[model samples]
Target: MKYDWILFDADETLFHFDAFRGMQVMFKRFGIDFTEKQYADYQLVNKPLWVDYQDGKISAEQLKVTRFQGWADKLNVTPKALNSAFLEAMADICTLLPGASELIEALTGQAKLGIITNGFTELQQIRLDRTGMSDYFEYVVISEEVGVAKPDGGIFAHAHQLMGNPCKSTVLMVGDNPHSDVLGGMNFGIDTCWLNTQAAQRPEGIAPSYEVSSLQQLQRILLA
Candidate 1:
């Protein structure tokens, strides 16, 4: 492997983050059928909140509560309660992305593994535990706990310190989001691999060190 340490973004990179499915499961407890239309409507409010969160305009708590506000109003429940239910539902349905486990297992003895995710703290560990991936990582840096999200160098810096201040050249950051994962890693002076599963165009001025369509490809690249 070219790097001594490999940092991953948790959600879509390692785990399947089916938010719509999670919401449907969550709302069932309240006797509501979460339809596709409703999920589309939900994303209208949720997506921008995530952007604001990564931009440091809002805190993770604010993003969590605010995204559920409309549903809370409809259900006559507190937003905090709804958010908790959503996280619990997500954890219950959590599964590793295809090839994620194999890649991690293959890299176990080759490089130190860590996670630097902008995802919430409440769900990360539980999902890792459920999927039996808890022991693979040496560090799990959650933005919610770190007080800064990805795309900000602060979270990566925090991860670096936790990683015992390893040489920047010996680190690789891999993620599904170009802006948060690739650009952030580049800005922080580390190599990055963009997992462009959707075949999205690379944004101008934000080139990653490598790009691949699947975890299988990434694993090959790393172990080549």
Candidate 2:
């Protein structure tokens, strides 16, 4: 492999993160039917909280709790309870992306693998375990635990430290989010691969070292 280490983002890069489905499952348990419009309303509050979280304006706990506070009030439950149920729902629904297993299997011996995720700590491990991906990665770095999200260099710095400070040139960070994953890796002085399966427009002021539509393509590029 061209890179000695390959780091991945957790949600949507390697596994499906169907937050709407997760929320529906979670709310069903509380006896409320979660509608698309409700989900849209939730996202209006939830998405900006995530942006604030990524921008270092709010802590993970605050984001998690605040996003669910409206529903929590309606359901007469604590925000933490709603959050935990949602994470549990997400974990139950997690699955590897197409070619995710093949890419990991192909890269196993060629390059050390790890995950550097801005995803929550609770959902990550259980999902990894369920998908039988726990043993494939050397490190599963969680921003919730690291106290910093991506696009900030600190989380990547923490991951690099855990990676034993490998030469920057020998590492690659692969993820779906351009700002956090691609730009963060670039700013951190490592190569990055953007998994642009959604085919979104490339944002200005950001460039990735590599871009591929699928993990299968990434496998070809890395092992070429």
* Per-residue lDDT over 79-112 for candidate 1, one digit per residue giving the tens place of the 0 to 100 score: 9999999999999999999999999999999999
Across residues 25-69, which tens digit of lDDT does each residue of candidate 2 receive?
988888888999999999999999999999999999999899999
TM-score of each model, in listed order = 0.99, 0.99
- Candidate 2 wrongly placed segments (more than 4 Å): none
lDDT of each: 0.96, 0.94
Q: Number of the top candidate by lDDT?
A: 1
lDDT of 1: 0.96
Model 2 lowest lDDT segment of ten: 23-32
